[model samples]
Target: MTDSMLKIENLHAEVEGKEILKGIDLEIRPGEVHAIMGPNGSGKSTLSYVLSGREGYEITRGSVSFKGKDLLALEPEERAGEGLFLAFQYPVEIPGVPNTTFLREAVNAVREYRGEERYDALKFMKFVRAKLKELGMADEFLKRAVNVGFSGGEKKRNEVLQMACLDPSLAVLDETDSGLDIDALKAVAEGVNALRGPERSFLLITHYQRLLGYIVPDRVHVLSRGRIVETGGPELAEKLEAEGYAAYVGEPEAA
Candidate 1:
């Protein structure tokens, strides 16, 4: 069998002197979609940040291996160059940079990192236009600043569009379904599903199971108190929806 695309062992992390992720171990092979379901303060976002080399978090122990490379040793930009992508819970606004410029820069950066040539103006515009058409977005979107004055659903859709264009090996979506209505949720889910492939994988971090109904996961792991309490198949999400996180993490207040 091929090696695991992402191997995380004994991972521990802290934020502002408070420990958030403790002893997390997970291995996601290629093409597998793994979901991390938990209540509030379960360290789901912490794990994502630690993997993506985000600032302000301290990893006191453990190692993360991405495609057999030392993930933690690299800087955040280096991690992005290595085909790791993180879709934030709240997509930040870039007031001045147009969405087209941001997407081209991101794609070109990754290509340049891998020793590939950057896309010229003609090629980039044509390519990005196809992507927008695929997602049912108008050309007007390319003129708007990134996430500036975008509604919650539009921001999430933009994130999905970015993921499609970048085509990362692994995508970590943190609470992507938050604040989205059912129609927007399904639209985003369809975009995500369209990108699924053998050479790619996904790590979905969510507080609710509704997203799972649209994008079924291969495995579901319940996180509580900075640790993964239980790992199961898609049915685990159903159980979480039915029974809640009480069994594994005690009461909601405790978390």
Candidate 2:
């Protein structure tokens, strides 16, 4: 058994009394990329939100542990402080906050939490510039408002930049591939792949296996009806790519 970085066992959750995730069990260890593929409304985003300690979700049963610490016990910021990052499917627009300011605050906050010295402004800007280069992005993006008036691909790339800055141990990327052109998708995949290492892990929540063609998960899990119905190696994703989810998704066909 591999030592787990994030473990969710039989997790059941709801929002406003409407059950979303039902009995979700997954384990991700360091250096492993685990892809969760399902149709829309299969509770994919819900799982990411719940794991990140987002508000409005109720966990009715089961448990989640990150690095052997009780995940449910941490507040959202606390979770981030502990090196758990969740990249949202839809990046929110912070109208008044410049992307640089938001990222600097976030990076320094996590650093402070970990008892590390904060970066000086110049040092931080240099750090961010290098990350952008790695992601095939330019420096002009740092001057814009966070997700405000940015293109879809830019927003997703910003999310990747944040991931690079924070260097989280576990990254839960919810629909990171949505709305990207082939080039943008490959860039995002390359960013993710660049971050892969023996001490890092990822939970890639996506609807299609196309992104898998780039990142290539170590394991592929089929989620249906709020539960994981099947799991296999990377070949499973190739199979799903060819056959589509209908042949395997046991849930009542998504309405």
Candidate 3:
């Protein structure tokens, strides 16, 4: 079996003729957490979208492997069924669908794909209840429409809830801390921490080091102008927090 949950080698991608990721290389092993920090348009979100198999982005070159499987060959739904999850920076609102129902269907779909037995109504509700409590969310949230009119913090919290329910092997959080208040930020962090285990890994993409203070990644990489310019430990986040991204904001490495 492969030791890494996700491996990206010389990944190059573009959208609308504009290159985004330029020869990026990264490896994520199980039980590890990595943070990618950079200024706006530094390919952090592009990496997340590319990993999740979102459309409209073209892969110019390189490879992405999840558990030794060719990630680029799989569809978006296939990626999810294979235990890859991406928490969007701006979660969308799905009106007319109750949050609980949406989550139950999503979970059951993944379970069915894995050839696992589907949950009954009571069993699913109980499972969701426990997960909600684990995420410090209220029962009332289940009754509301899926992210419809939800506050910024609420949407992020709900994203965590979904992640907890799914129990993915590799989770990519793109700007999850954006627009969250201090209290909500802690709640989101706590929820993420609860899901931390040896079988799981995370790639956290954020602009500020404050989220890193809560998540405390095992490593940090600075992405600049379409590639990772610097890779370091937690102290790199502190340095960026102190001095800002100016230190690493320059021309990307030659391809």
Task: Write model 3 residue lDDT over 1-255, tens digit each, in one string.
Answer: 999999999999999999999889999999999999999989999999999999999999999999999999999988999999999999999999999899999999999988898898899999999988777789999999999989999999999989998889999999999999999899899999999999999999999999988999999999998888889999999999999887677553563
The list of candidate 1 runs beyond 4 A from truth reads 251-255
TM-scores of the models, in the order given = 0.96, 0.95, 0.98
**After superposition, which runs of candidate 3 have C-alpha atoms over 4 Å from their true positions?**
252-255
- Expressed as tens digits, the lDDT of each residue in 8-36 for candidate 1 is 99988889999888789999999999999
Worst 10 residues of 1 by lDDT: 246-255
Residue pairs whose backbone atoms clash in candidate 1:
none
Candidate 3's TM-score reads: 0.98
Top candidate, metric lDDT: 3
Worst 10 residues of 3 by lDDT: 246-255
Which residue pairs clash within candidate 3?
Answer: none
> Model 2 off-target regions past 4 Å?
250-255
Give the candidates in order of TM-score, highest first. Answer: 3, 1, 2
**How close to the true structure is residue 176 of candidate 2, measured as C-alpha lDDT?**
96
Across 26-126, the per-residue lDDT of candidate 2 in tens digits comes to 99998899999988878999999999999999999999999999999999999999999998889999999999999999999999999999998998998
Cα lDDT computed for each candidate against the true fold: 0.91, 0.91, 0.93
